[model samples]
Target: MKEARYFYVPNAVTETELPADEATHALRVLRLKEGDELFLIDGEGGFFRAEVALTTSKKCVYTIKQTLKQEPTWRGGIHLAIAPTKDMGRMEWLVEKATEIGFNKISFLDCKFSERKSLRVDRIEKIIISAVKQSRKGWKPVVEPMIPFHQFIDNCTSAGQKNICHCYSEISKLDFFTEANQSLEEDILVLVGPEGDFSFDEVRYAMEHGFKSVTLGESRLRTETAGLFAVMISQLARRV
Candidate 1:
């Protein structure tokens, strides 16, 4: 079985301290002693395989024994920009699952029909950290704060495949999965709307900016579900 890993804010090479809660868990709950092996990850980048040199009720100190350059598992890149669910718990769930499925970036947008306008980044960061460790991943997704729908679309820097998963009544010119040709490297950005869906104007704005509208499936999924669905579909498409 893979060893349990934990995210430490700073790169472990320099002397570092774990957060109070994490310290308590590692030293007191886990009963990890000096010279024990544990993995440390700097959320920014890189993984440190370290040997715990000191342990106390309040702290666990380690000596970095090895360093591994972290890389994404998927050769293809996937970024999902979606509206946050009104229920904060559901939003957290989305972050966890999407991280496990290998999302490179996640952004929140305030669409015309969005009901929840604000989000707590501090709490969301904690959730992402937990999800990254849970999935045994070396790197975490980049989570951006809420942005206006149009502004988010306009700021996209990726020149590869761009798509929007919407259920608008207009007949889509092409399905999202079919829009990208196999010759291109696996980089894609998929936009999903809020509970009430994107306003007609926001949809037009995205289309004008080269975000092709495509459907996830015939069934209408909730905001979080649609976001997850898009991640799964894109992952599969890249493999094929």
Candidate 2:
């Protein structure tokens, strides 16, 4: 028997043909043949146990054998918003790790002290997809385009406990885990700053706008690390 493989096929519940890129990978790279087992992930919330029905140089068709709907691993929603670091690699690494741990969404914030103002969201989306496939996560985390720090806060009026992590001592900060644990099933969002950290004014603005000031711990962490730490802590809180 041949080994089974998973492919990201959006709307796999209805669509029998894999996307062009996935089709190419299936035929050219994997050399999958007709009747090979294939697991299809729709990225929304459906998984289809399938087998290759037909294959050509550029196309791979599949026949669904079973339909499965997966339950989310964690209760509530975990959202992490962060300022992009100068090196794109660090941000990409964070996205991969956080996705593996599982989260509902991730957003990029253009902060006051941010070094890199712009980033390729498309490239980051690919990383998220790959992570979802690797971890066998049922739902894919949503990645938003980078937006100004203030603009994002202004538009975000959703129902959830919002927390912002920063380095200033003058402003009071709370323990992230303890705070996040307060409402296990409620949606939670954590904001992490850039290398230089959010300016005092930005911190004040967030605090004034209902974003609680929270610290990951006593140790100072880089931008990417802080983001991942927040993600891990949030997931842990929901698990318990």
Q: Count the backbone clashes (under 3 Å) in each candidate.
A: 0, 0
Candidate 2: worst 10 consecutive residues by lDDT? 1-10
lDDT string for model 2 (76-164, tens) is 89999999999999999999999999998989999888999999999998999889888887788999999999998998799888999
* Residue 185 in model 1: lDDT: 76
Q: TM-score of each candidate?
A: 0.89, 0.97
- The numbered model that scores best in TM-score is 2
Q: Write the per-residue lDDT of candidate 1 for residues 1-240, one digit (tens) a residue.
A: 635656554555666656676777787777788777788776656788878788766887777788877765555678899999889898899989988877788989998888899999888888888887777677778889999988898897667788887777874646766654443475888889989988878887888898887887778899999998888877777653
lDDT of each: 0.79, 0.91
Model 2, residue 17: C-alpha shift (Å): 0.7
Q: Model 1: clashing residue pairs?
A: none
